[model samples]
Target: MRVSVILPAKNESEGLGRVLPLLRSVLPEAEIVVVDDGSTDDTAEVAAAAGARVLSSPYSMGNGAAIKRGARAANGELLVFMDADGQHNPADIPLLLARIEAGFDMVVGARGASGQASTGRGLANAFYNRLATWMTGHRVLDLTSGFRVVRADRFREFLHLLPNGFSYPTTSTMAFFRSAYPVAFVSVDVVKRIGNGSHIRPLRDGVRFLLIIFKIATLYSPLKLFAPAGLLFFLVGLGYYGFTYSTMGRFTNMSLLLLSASVIIFLIGLVSEQITALTYTRPDRP
Candidate 1:
């Protein structure tokens, strides 16, 4: 199958200059597409100089948006996505492709502990991986790794589901699992990023980190996350009601509120579960 390597870059001219040549040397036949996310630097020029097809946006659209643009514009049967920064190694591309050839629908280059940019990011990723593993009942070595290879047709199917922000990898991985598509992980080590420092802000993106937890549950199985929460509220409310009835011989408003909240949360989960199921339905199906 023909392969397309896609790199979404923003002010990464230095890294692209290093990565693009390595990519060309490693996979001469594969199509290379570098998406310039409105970089003020010479990112587009550097990519073009390396003989990669360049796609430039007018303004900084977002990492996920650049990915979507590259995916839509690529012309290969297999799409390989890697970081534009120098962290991801081009030599490991073959490993991901091997897994895809082994009948897996997608293959991710799972990063080791040493590959993380920082200890806090590593810890956060560990939590995400555990949560995803529990939600999908699969061993998820890396839930947020950007280095992966997937069938273009299958990946395109979920373009609408991908956010324009930073968590496209999270959304795509969970979507594949929820749809029963085979996904595999191959261990890979990453180096320090080249060019400009990481664009992710600790303060702003930290909030997005929490949202990713909710996104994971809603993407795979909403009930798996919401059910336990509702049960917790129910149990607490029941205990409070028992204590109040024994002491005051009356049902208290606080207990009533908790009980009502339990029921509401559960009903919301039930509805959300149905909605989530519908999202995975094939468009051809009636």
Candidate 2:
């Protein structure tokens, strides 16, 4: 099958200079598309000089936005997405592609603990993986790895569900599990990124990290998250009511409020489940 390797870059001219040539040496026949996400540097020129097809945005779009643009523009049967920050090794492309050929719809390169950029990031990813595993009832080795190869057609199916921000990998991974698509992971190591430091700011993206937790549940199965929450509220309400009846001999407003909240949360989960089901219905399906 034909393959397209997409690199999303922003002010990563130095990284691109190194990555592009290595990518060419590995998959010479594959279509290499460099998405220059409004870089002030010479990212586009560097990619062009190395014989990669360049797609440039006038202004900075987020990493996920660049990914969507590249996916739409690629004309390959398989789509390979990796960071242009020099952390993702080009040699690992074939390992992921092999899994794609083995009947998996998507294959992600899972990083070991040491591969994480920092201690905090590693811990955060560990939490995401565990939560996703519980949500999907399948072990998720890596829920946020950017290096992945997927069948182009299947990948594009979830394009509308993908966010235009940093959490695209998280969103897409959960979507695949929800849709029952076969996904696999292969362990890989990463090196320190070249050029400028990470674009992600801990203070700014912290809120986004929290949103990703909610997104994971909502994307795969909202009931998994909401049901437990509702149950907790119900238990608290029941306990409070029992206490009040034994002591004050009355059903208090606090008990009523807790019970009401429990019911409302469960109802919301039910509605969200239906909506989530509709989200996965293929447009081509009747």
Best by lDDT: 1
What C-alpha RMSD separates each model from the true structure?
A: 0.9, 0.9
lDDT of 1 by residue, 151-203 (tens): 99999989999999999999999999988889999999899999788999899
TM-score of each: 0.99, 0.98
- Candidate 2, RMSD to the unseen true structure: 0.9
Candidate 2 TM-score over all chains jointly:
0.98
Give, for candidate 2, the lowest lDDT window spanning 10 residues. Answer: 277-286
List model 2 lDDT by residue over 1-286, tens digit each.
9999999999999999899999999999999999999999999999999999999999998999999999999999999999998999999988998888889999999999999989999999999999999999999999999999998998899999888899999999988888889999999989999999999999999999999999999999998888889999999999999999999999999999999999999999999999999999977853
Q: Let me know the TM-score candidate 1 reaches against the reference structure.
A: 0.99
